[model samples]
Target chain A: MSERSPQRISRSALPYPYRADGLVFDVQAVLLDGEERVDVNVSRANRRWAFPTDDWERCRIVGTVELPSSVVDAVYPESERDSPPGSLYVTIRCRETIYRDRWMVQSETVEPKTYEVELELQRDGFRGEVELKPYLTRGAADQSTDDGSYASSTHARLASARPWTMLVDGEADADGETGLDVRVESFSTSPRLPKDGLYYLDMGDPSDPLIVVNGEHNRVVGVLQSEGSVGAEARMRDVVFDQIQYGVWSQLILHAGVAVDSTGRPQYDWQSTVLRIFARDLYGIDDIHAASRRLKRDLKDPTTVPEVMQRIDRVLQRYLRQREQLINLMEEGLRI
Target chain B: MSSGDVDTDDGRLADNTGTPLRTLTSEGRRLVDPAFLRGERTYADEVGQYVDEHTSDVHVELQGLRADLQAVVDSYDQYDSTIDAAAAPAVHRRLDISRRIAADPGVWHYLAVVEFPEFVRYRWEFNTETAMREKFLGAGTDIYSNALHRLWWIAELTHDGDDYSLTEEVLQKQTLANKIFDRWFARYRPAAVACCAKLVDESTEVAEEVTLRLNRVFSTRQLEGMDEAELGRLIQDLVTDIQNQGTTD
Candidate 1:
């Protein structure tokens, strides 16, 4: 009787993936292209986004798609029974919305006739926990589910089975969802750039702190983005990221300290938040008051400018744990 | 969620269209300057630089969408309710809705940068000045920020197959779209349409209250694993509850 309510249908009224005969995808194992075959956990499949750089390769999902003929008959209308009742196209779809590439190795129309699949995933920007499921699509071309049906896109999803998720663990540097937005930008266009260093932190946007990696020098976008991901360029990437973090922390702390000195506190909330979180995590400093106290006190010879750099270096040594991180950096070199 | 689009022509809109739908990484998204997004730079400006490192054979055509969007923005001076009502359906149809491609941050990034820079700039009010970075980059991930993506997603969620009535209703106010999208049921098409239907006609205060109540109900009642009968029953209960609140008021 409510005027606001529209024509209400029972929840089951609309066709909401309601199929009496649903198919299941039994993903057996994952194969590194032309190399090692890693058995899938059935629950979730995981392939590293981080391996070494030179040896990096694409991955493939190997599985069996099961659908009894009775299911095929029940779901699809008879060959002569209706108009263009499209074929059931089957494949594994990347359930991650953030991934750039969702193109699977293949998609196929599996009759009771065909069942096996060996689909490949293009190793471009593939990271994090990627959930893949054997999906049933209504239209588009056909082949074996994972084997021959590899395509970039598929049509209307007919049904979805229990999804299998995979965790591709990589280094900390490869994460994109961090508070600090680290980027690779060519500084040649930034005419007013004060420093043409390996990296520069653009602190203009008080809310969003940016770390611009100077592409003018090394142009190692891969090393920076990929880091320990599928292509493990571990040493150089780790050292670069470490140095960048150090610089960012030093500049921010210095800026916060200067702001507190002039006024009562840091000019921005982000400054306060970062000082509290990072300072606490990296150093033993707990509260903002303690941080404020620490920032005002200086290294020996407080009047001297280079002394600030000296203090930063001393803190960096502790944060980096001179022996630990540096040792990890050299472990790669020693391997070479 | 009903991806009814079939392949047309050389499969530009189809699943098999082997054209790579390019994307920019989160890091790459930061490199996108307001000037670059305002169509001041071409792909040669390295605006197309830092493309997601994918070897997928699929490629997407970076067609010019500036003139069309310029007309809309020039005429309306907004992501104005009027503009959204007209534009969402057009954009949805043009992109040839496929959830697989629709959900890719890279595809939206590519479109915003390589294909439709003006779309992002005009929508986010990039008038020779910087706008928020998330506005340019947050497609596919965030429900609200990305100008181009939210349009497609809005149209996708509300439109009954071949019907734009609900989409137009939701787009009647930007705030309403936010209310519908910011909920757990936003991804579920039926629930989204139901929520829009329930809220579209109510006063702003009443709608907001109902949505708040629904949010509380959703927190305790997970919608993910629920089937149609159960979800329908739950939604029906909310509708009755909303009617009672109307009576109370």
Candidate 2:
């Protein structure tokens, strides 16, 4: 299994030169693994720096760069003089590198290294550029003293590798006897971060489908484990969540091993899934764990169906009764 | 382009209130402010002070653009007498501005620099009125308002990466174009919007068919009864059928 390299550094340490007349300005460039590069600029005029198109033209680099394409991307030009502003920023993946000597060096004895370059310019002209030296220090490795319970990296890897899936348990014919008698036990919400551990389910049978329920905020609300290779899944965590303070929960259904229809769309019969009951602001870890355990136990127990359904209905009714309040909560969250 | 007799501060042109119009010029571009443009003060501010100090040939050129726009409206009316009369005036207003901006890049640059809230406000007002009166149909929708918004919405509703031609196709169909604006305020998901657009394109029966189906689907027990995954799949299926029909037939 391949693990993504962890590269975290501050803005100051990154390389780049900066110069300004009367306004403050800064620029940073990073060359990643000798395969990808990124350049960022921030200036007082626009307070945002963008990759200069003339630079690429002057550098005469070949292969496609990671700038937004004018054809597919629509932009309101700030001024006619600034044509094809390249991008407000750019991350160029290496089809090739111009500097052979400046390649990323790695060794068995050393942790991975990252190099950054920065430059700042004023209205007049070039200000300064800085080159960030690679940080060679490594953090402590996992030890036995750490918590015994660890997250499943297999699930994480799979989630990242196969981010989209179709739901099978939800697809079971509602009118047919084959439908699984699934019931909601308990429901709780948790804040999903930029990086969240993944949990995998093998439906035990290849014929059965996996069901995922996503919420409105794109959170994974529930997962229905069915029997099979119905390979539908979603990224357990989303990249967008990195910058957002408030998280959304989604009800998703994943069906495994589905093929695209003639129209380049997925073809799958998703099963019935419902968000019967929900609890809010249960921010404590213990509270969430307890709720999950309760739900799992109730789902396993056939006798809890009527009670679960009643509780779900009650919660939903309460929510509907407080629709205005819910809206206010959402608005408040947005303000935050 | 040159106003030799024009007073620097107080331009002679005055509104019905008898106050001289403020005038500003920068890089040979002239701006006359009956009302101040929003945002930070620039050369326009200096010109307003200049107008306050002097009162000659204040708004001769400013009035010229206004007259040019009115003339364009009159010409459009002459060209299409039977066109929606209520919409014609507003459409002409926008067309006049667009034409001027297209022809004289300096005016366009000045417009950009001034950052007048009134300009945007009036443009939006005209756009909304035209859209409402015309049943939300017209190529003018993209040309008259924020070009960025028009381009984005067109790209979004059209089939993936196929909007280059479909944009024109969508704009040409008055009924379909109207439907786009009608549903602009609807609370449907992003996927739902695409589905609706696809449905409109796939069928010749107009947007009513798809809209009616969507309404019925939402109102039925299916919407509340089905799980999220189920709803997504069903919607995807409908959209797929529509898209398939669009490409094939």
Candidate 2, residues B1-249, lDDT tens digits: the string is 233334333223322212222322322222322122221234534433322221221222343433443454455433232222222232222222221122222223233333222323333333233232221111121222332223233433343442234444554454565454444222122433444445445444535555555544543111212223544455556556665776798
List candidate 2 segments past 4 Å from native.
A1-336, B1-168, B173-175, B178-249
What is the lDDT, from 0 to 100, of the residue B46 in candidate 2?
47
lDDT by residue (A174-289, candidate 1, tens digit) is: 22223666677788787535555777888544335778887777646566665463223766666667777887878876765554432124434445654554444433555555
* Residue-by-residue lDDT tens digits, candidate 2, A45-66: 3322233322221111111111
lDDT of 1 by residue, B122-196 (tens): 566554344445556655435675677878888877787778888888887778777778664566655677777
Worst ten-residue run, lDDT, model 1 chain A?
A2-11
True contacts kept of 2: 0.00
Ten residues in a row with the worst lDDT in model 1 chain B?
A: B1-10
- Scored by CA lDDT, what does every candidate get? 0.54, 0.28
Per-prediction TM-score: 0.49, 0.22
